[model samples]
Target chain A: MKKTLALATGLAAALGLGQAAAQVSDDVVKIGVLNDQSGLYADITGQGSVLAARMAAEDFGGSVLGKKIEIVFGDHQNKPDVGSNIARQWLDVDKVDAIADVPTSSVALAIQEITKTKNRVFLISGAASSDLTGKACSPTGFHWTYDTYMLANGTGGALVKAGGDSWFFLTSDYAFGHALERDTGAAVTAAKGKVVGQVRHPLNTSDFSSFLLQAQASKAKIIGLANAGGDTINSIKQAAEFGIVAGGQRLAGLLVFITDVHSLGLKTAQGLVVTESFYWDLNDETRAWSKNFMAKHGGKAPTMVHAGVYSAVKHYLTAIKEAGTDEAGKVAEKMRQMPVNDFMTKNGQIRQDGRVMRDAYLLQVKKPEESKGPWDYYKVLSTIPAKDAFRPIEQSECPLVKKS
Target chain B: MFELLGVPPQALFGQLLLGLINGAFYAMLSLGLAVIFGMLNVINFTHGAQYMMGAFCAWMLLKFLGLNYWFALILAPIIIGAFGILLERLFLRRLYNLDHLYGLLLTFGLSLIIEGVFRNQFGSTGQPYDNPLPGGQNLGFMFLPYYRAWVVVASLLVCLATWFVIERTRLGAYLRAATENPTLVQAFGINVPRMIMLTYGFGVGLAGLAGVLAAPIYQVSPLMGSNLIIIVFAVVVIGGMGSILGSVITGFALGVVEGLTKVFYPEASSTVIFVIMAIVLLVRPAGLFGQTR
Candidate 1:
């Protein structure tokens, strides 16, 4: 009887060793969060993005397939080379199965190239350039939320429809701004509107008096400021001071954030129409989620890019869970096939080309006098359906598609 | 047709005027940098941060002290200039014996710390300053805001005035002589150390003055001076370091070229000035107006 017991113990030990090896083979997933930590995109996706990924991991029970999930993060510094190098290290050495929240489009595009070659999943949440899923589309990449095309179509088209037919563009002279101007111009033209003229200003330009005067002289019905961040806020404010808005033309913000509008206040920003994918105070679920987010983010409301980070990280974890193994190809496939569910988005589906189809919102900044509370700055003018907010699948240049 | 990139007469002139406006700021900032470098032999990386601080100071003065644009126009520079003097006396003066690179590094670090603190406190969003000069005059081709025209004219006058002080005055002669032979100037009991400190303060004060003028036109933000300074550095290099009039001329010229690029290529607008800097470096390694010592 002693000999039989010893043999049984040895067999149990052998079985345990086999299980451990298999677990190592199938588990131990690593993910990377590479984003701008100290540059222009930092405010949108700095340490906050890392925190969101951690939150998602916690919500995922911190383990998948009986294997602990580890997330390593780095600052890409908003440079393409830096982003690609970090991606290479994460994929080759650290073996990160997926990368999330690459903010700058130039950096995001380089990372997409690396991920594609390595067969790793790359979810882009903060990049505003539409080329990510447009001409520069890659199989390994997913543009999770917001793009130039949607912004142009929503803000430009809506304003054009509202008899802002004659337009003057105060465009920033860069690839991003050029794309936005092109898309917005096309949208306005499609809506039977005329573009009077455009003045291209330098990025981060301080003075807009010359551009504003040019716009003023053009006498267009709408003065569309196709810029972002400080440039946008400055142009709009200067325009108001110059009496361009008060004189005749209306101000339309092609790309604006809750923070920018907040900083400008309703007096300067009021009556300006903008388009965004997410607003903190949209619905009961959003309000509740945003309350926590705002509290965590120091009472300032979440920007679209911030909300996108929250949603993309959550979806990525969900995909990893469903895939069982942390193989990039499998997880990406799962992400594409499955519907996305998160605080920022509900009933959202990832198209075959990896565009997250979600509703876009048209919002108007409220008058300061009309505000009931501190954070209540925007009034939702209309809800653009998911189908209308984004370009149709046929317009996409992505080669991979379902058999349908 | 002798036309520049198919641009109509009105459009070309309009871009030219626009370029002149941008060049005005570039010239002023570069002039200040040259003055500081001439006296202290240190590249003020903090110049950008200081310029940003100047804008923020003006904004704060308006918000907290109920100071209007006119008062800020006067007091902002004095306050910031005194701060510059303090910075130099306490910190920069200690580095005079070291390699010039050390001073650059220290200033760079200081800039990072200042920018970081401002970013942390105020967030990345910009605060607007109302235009002090309320109205604009309608030109034939374009409506010129009075404040913008004032910025160009004021910046030019300040640049010229600083050049006059440094190039023409007796105090300027002492400052120049001291830069040439510090020990000799010190032996003459001219108080060279105090003069150096005051020079730095004066240079930084120019940046602050530029900032105050800029507050109404530009959004007051921590990042306002960073990218602008890089271009100004390029402008300085292209104009030849230590050449006041060169900076003013090159600043305006590059601005016009950049404006023209916007009309023609558009994609190269941001990069045109850098390209010019590279070209100027190849043609004249010491810069178009710089002495090749």
Candidate 2:
């Protein structure tokens, strides 16, 4: 009996040393939330994302494999060089296990490369570029939020079906805007619709009178606003003053956040079609989670980017626990193997190309009267399934796909 | 029916008109800058923040006090200008005898602090203000929003009135004399210090009025003034600093030029104003209307 008890103790110690105790590097798991904290994209992703990441850590029992979870954040100021510098410091000096919630595509792409070289996980939630998963897919990068392709598929298809065929585009002149225009233009033309004209405006532009005049001259049935955050809000508000909608030209917001709707108020933003992967009022679970988030966030509801950060961090933590280590490649494999379930996501699956396959909803901005209360902005038009929502495997250009 | 270099005549005409509307803002903003410089011998770098404060004041009045747009139009400037008066007394009054650089540095730092504080209070996503003149008439050339037309007419009146006061009145003469000989003006019992304070307040009032007018066209955001302030400064430089009539004319002309660029190239619209400023500085240095000191 004494020999048996000693043998059991020795085996338990060996297993613990081999697995959980010895594998996690740095004695703690650190996540760096890098995004625009004081620029145009600030309200959309800023400190809300950091808070979401912290909430995720707390929800996951506050630690992984006996290592305390730490969330650190930095403001990228929507600049690529600034974002890359922060990412380098976080990975090399601070030993951050992952970086998440980078918004600007230029900045995210820059950080993606650096994080890949450093062998750290990149859980992108705020950026909209498809290239992160298309041609630039890294083994350690997981695009966990909506992308340009998903936006084009969901909102573009909805508008085409609603009898708004001929389109004009007001594109923000940047990587995300260009990709959205390109992908949506393809989707529009594929549906037997015509693109009449397109004008590229500089990012963070305040005035849209000139651009709106150009679109009004085009006489397209629909005007697609391929921009986000402050730029989107300004264009929409200016469009109303110019009577773009009253003149029978509908504005399609390819990407719109709840915060933007709140900023514009429901009166101006009504009747616009938008695509998003998550909304705070989607279901009971989302409501429970969002209420807590709202209380902590000064009564502001979380944008999809914020929700994605929370979900992705939670999943990353789970994957680390499951894989028994925070090794970038191994944990990434484990994350891809496990299906994601969260407050907003019901059936989320990560593909081999590092894209989070999730259902994006087709939504229409509710009229002021239709809104039941504050933060009640969208009414889901249709449920776009994960398979139909994301880029089909055959069309994927990522090298990770076997092409089978 | 005719096309000029790729753009149709109608489009060209429309864009030029739009340029004038934008120029209205430039004229009003630079007019204030010119007034402060001409009277106080200090470059008011805080003009942009003062403008932003004007818009925020309008927003606060409406959101907190239930005041309408028309009320904001008249009251916002007075309120913000009073705040500007406090700034002048508490800070700007100290650097009157120093080099111009000292004043510029002090004003520039104050502006950053003001902008940063506002940004912290309201996230970068701007708040929307209702349009007072929602209805518009479509001119034959393009869709002409009524607000745009009002902006042009209203600013022209304000500019003329301001120009008349500074260039054609007795008080204007006293102000000019004080700039040239403050001690003599003081011995004449004109209260030169009080005149300087009022001058700063008046200049800041103009910025606040421009902000109230702009609250609808642009979202009431902290960065709105900064975004357009650079262009207005270029207008001031191109018009020649401290020249009242020069600021007004150059403001409208540069605006028309910027509009034409938006129509033809679109990409260069933002840079077109700066390019003209550079060229003007290279050629005339004192500006198109400035007397070389």
Candidate 3:
């Protein structure tokens, strides 16, 4: 009985120490980098996000409050249940104060719920669903980078205005695709264009002949592809084979990355227009950072997701330092109130709805014979200012907002 | 220029023909899965990776070995089949007595490893394989691409030939007997273990062959098979787990249904196959043509 009592006392002391470490810890501020390490999003954000986060930590001098800052990471495997469980573990056991760089929207939504429940901060950098800041907005969450609305408004609105007015969509059949189609369709209508018809293709569809034939038969001026990854590449390639492009119908890729354009080669993907929040060759700073990033990562260019990771991590750390505490509510308030400053971002501000205000660039894929160096795939035709790139705050459906 | 149900004859026929082409792939893949499950009693989860590897093999043969598509079409499956044999002998054979779930887990792990290694080497972007037969013969309503026609015909021949070998041959009789009672087959002085190994190898080769055919149409990538395999699995279960011809028929039928769904209600195009599987389970319990045994 005496030994048992002594053991219980020792356990209580250990528990007390753990609580003290979590609450009044002086040496380290822990941030969780939750993302898909080995799934579809992996190519966009996986190890590169981790490296980018580490670079941010290093840029922050690796320590804050006379203590070191550390990042803990886990692969959610693109499942919401797994992602939520990981977030819970990170918050409760790992004592993570902030989470960043969640790529999958479903996973991001699940994690946002967990973070909101736990009163922990979440900095979403990679996921593109507009719901992050719209209906699912949280006081504890800040969507730092891109979203579907920005993409649709930037590309769709611009393309519609450019006289590719009539559209026939070949969309992937999924939540993301549905959302993109809806947003882009609205943008097209808003810009005085019309959708002649639309066809839903299965996600990761190998063949696009049927869908392409539908688009061709529609005789629409524009063939809008609301898909990503392999589906987009295949549709565009087969469309070329079917002589659809030769028939004078333009192909608009709503969501495309530099990597995909590279894979398709400029010859095939030429004249395709896309909108992005960041590019590696934008300016001197972007080029310098990208050159180092590419050199470290085997000469592969950094996609928007990679750049977002770096910028988001840097901003989150700056917020954490400004707040002087790892508390989510406190840090989130400071994040919104403070101007977001980073190498990739210039005078960006986080709105009350947690949407990070930034410019979106419209790029046209350069032809192979354009006589440029390697990785010079895009020619920036226009830059959509931050205010115009995303849907206005008045149009947002977030319930959290009150019309003052 | 005849119009039917708001779709022109050319467009409707073209969609139907595309549906048939997709059906061929579905039939071939599910047939291989059913054959593998029939004898090995293990769901080859790495079937997709093996399929992807087959395409990569064809690409590599062309890029490095100076071999063309026709040669790679024959040699790639053999090379992939040899790899399958080695995999079955070394790793898969060890799980013969455990719960079949272990085999699924092992193969799932192998799939991740194979896909990861490929992704590490080739990246996630699709690498285009040049179409060996580029031009198409102009049909009345539609232009039938030579590669598309070749794929449909080749998959049909392979599927029918496999059915013949399994249903009509005496060797297949012994294989079926072993599936029923391995100990009895062993007692009859037949090599049951070797048969099991060879069956897995053959099933994997079928997936590899499908991959080679798909390489020209779809870019050669590690992810080429992962998505298709899930739908094929649903096809297998809906067609009755171990029924060979049921899987083949169901695969083609479901593909056509999916294509039609795209034409009518495009929203359900991705989900129509799963919906049909759910319906089949509710109505037939053992599938449309599947037997309970």
Candidate 4:
């Protein structure tokens, strides 16, 4: 009887040790959706991105390897310091496996460095600077959605090809704007077009009358707005008021979003061509997913950033499941090896430089008479395939991409 | 194509007109700040939020009540002013006996609450206020929008009228006298507290009027005033926050200076005003028109 009792105690201890090991290997997967929650960029990637991320987790069966998935968010307020601090705290304290949907480029760059040091995944969706993949690419960072290169090649190249060649840029004086202007300028030049002039405005400028007048005086065929969010909306509205278009000069919103188009209304934003990676009305799959998002998001349609968050989160979970662990390096490797097929992208492949190569659309804002429901804002002009839409790998400056 | 200062005449004139419009707004807002600061001895940090409220009030009036721009012009200031009076009675009156910094802190907190509430409801995207006076005639040198021209003229009139009422009227004399010795004025049965309340209300009302005027030109957003208020404060600082006429003149002059900077060096336009403020502080700390305290 004493020997049998001792044997039972040994078996119980061994079983307990095995359960502890399993728990350590398959803990909860926590994702932090950090972006501008209360500032200018909030409209595009605020609570909506958080909701999309949650939906992605739910769609992924809510758990991976028996660990429940959790989504958390923070408001970076478009400040770099604030963002990096939150990222460090999330990584160190909360054990967040990934950070996603960082919008502003400066903040995104700051968080990217932190994620690199911690070996956590950084899913960039809202930010538009191509420098993420160019000079700042990280093994753990994935540039999932649109970037400045895509915008420049889509809107700038299309406009130049369509004879709206002479360009004047009203650039917001910052990293994002500078990258956008550089890329668009290159695209214009590549299309055999001339850039007449450009003026750089400070971020969050309330007035653009003086800048618009300068663009008008240049007599550029197109006024390329190298700004986004509120700046883009204000410049476009003032341009309309100043009769910039009526004076025979067109306005190209290089980084305009659907939110901006909604704010401007079709009456004023008409005839302006823009580029986007995902439009809610693009197809049946996008329509269904966006409708689901809108129902969860107070009838607000999902921007590309929100949609990209959903896709990135879903893809990240898939990678973790395939790798059978939450080890950042292993999951990132699996992510790179797998092709991204989702409602947001079809056969989207992650390049070595970390840019998600996917098709982009050049769209024109519909006129008021374009009969449709409230969210039907775009008329698709053209589609640039994934190969032609992004910067070529040979020209990449990212150290991660080796020379062929 | 005539050239002025290495820029085309059309561009230069257009920038000048734009500057004048901006100056008009500065003059109105700074004048309000001066009126409140002169009498109440509080910085009225809520001045910007009040200005934003005026614009939002105009927007709400149009959206909910189907009121036109003209009606909003008349009603928004009065409604916002009434709210200002209530605020003074409930909160600001208690801070009058405390340090000036307390008043500033209180109003700063109030401004945040007001701005936050609006942001929560509307988000940051600006709503368009249709141009009441649309289109413009092409001048020989530049195109002039009728709405912009109206704004310039109306703001000038409003500024001058505010100046006249404060510097020239009997009520103005009483208000100014109360500012000097509130206790003594109270002994004379002049009801100094009521005067202080009215002064604050009137000052915030001026901000409201400016908001109504600015609605068509700027997208009405929660941040509309916060963006412009910092510049107006600099205008007030440069003008010396002393005499009403001083703030008005300084506001217009600095606006022209900023516009000229944009034409010559577009990059410096944003900082030109602050640079002028530093120069003014060094040369004459009391401001161009301020009395030495």
Question: Candidate 1: where are CA atoms >4 Å away?
Answer: A1-28, A135-140, A167-175, A195-220, A241-243, B1-5, B283-285
Instruction: Write candidate 3's Cα lDDT for A1-404 as tens digits.
Output: 56753454355346553332233243358878888776555667777788888888888887543345798889998778898888888888877878888976777888878888889888888787788888888888888878889989888888888888899999877666777888889899988999898988766677788788789889899998888777788888788766678768889899888888877778778888999999888999999999988887878898888888888777777766666655668778878888877767899988878899999999989987883798899989899899998778998887777766
- Give DockQ per model, in order: 0.38, 0.66, 0.41, 0.61
Best-first order by lDDT: 2, 4, 3, 1
- The candidate that wins on DockQ is 2
**How well is each residue in B1-293 modelled by candidate 1, as lDDT tens digits?**
36555655776677678788878888888988888887778888899988888899899999999999889988988888998999998999999989989999999999899988988877767676777887877676555678879999999889889989989999999999999999999999999999999999998998999899888777787888886889889998899987777887888888788777766766467788899989989989988988876
**Pairs that collide, model 1:** none
Measured as a fraction from 0 to 1, the native contacts recovered by model 3 come to 0.40
Model 2's CAPRI class is medium
TM-score order, best first, reads 2, 4, 1, 3
Tens-digit lDDT track of model 3 for B1-293: 55788777777777788888898888899899999988888999999998999999999999899999999989988988889999999999999899999999999999989998998888777577877887676566666778889999999999999999998999999999999999999999999999988888899999999999998888787788886889888899898887889988888888788777767776667788888889889998987767777
**After best superposition, candidate 4 residue A403: deviation in angstroms?**
1.8
Positional deviation of A286 in candidate 3, in angstroms?
1.3
Candidate 3 stretches with Cα past 4 Å from truth are A1-27, A173-175, A201-209, A371-374, A393-404, B1-11, B39-42, B94-102, B135-144, B168-196, B240-243, B278-293
lDDT of 1 by residue, A122-173 (tens): 8888777787787777777888878888998999988988889988899877
Worst 10 residues of 4 chain A by lDDT: A17-26
Writing each residue's lDDT as its tens digit, candidate 2 over B156-226 gives: 99999999987899999999999999999999989998888988999999999999999998888888878
Model 3: colliding residue pairs: A27-A67
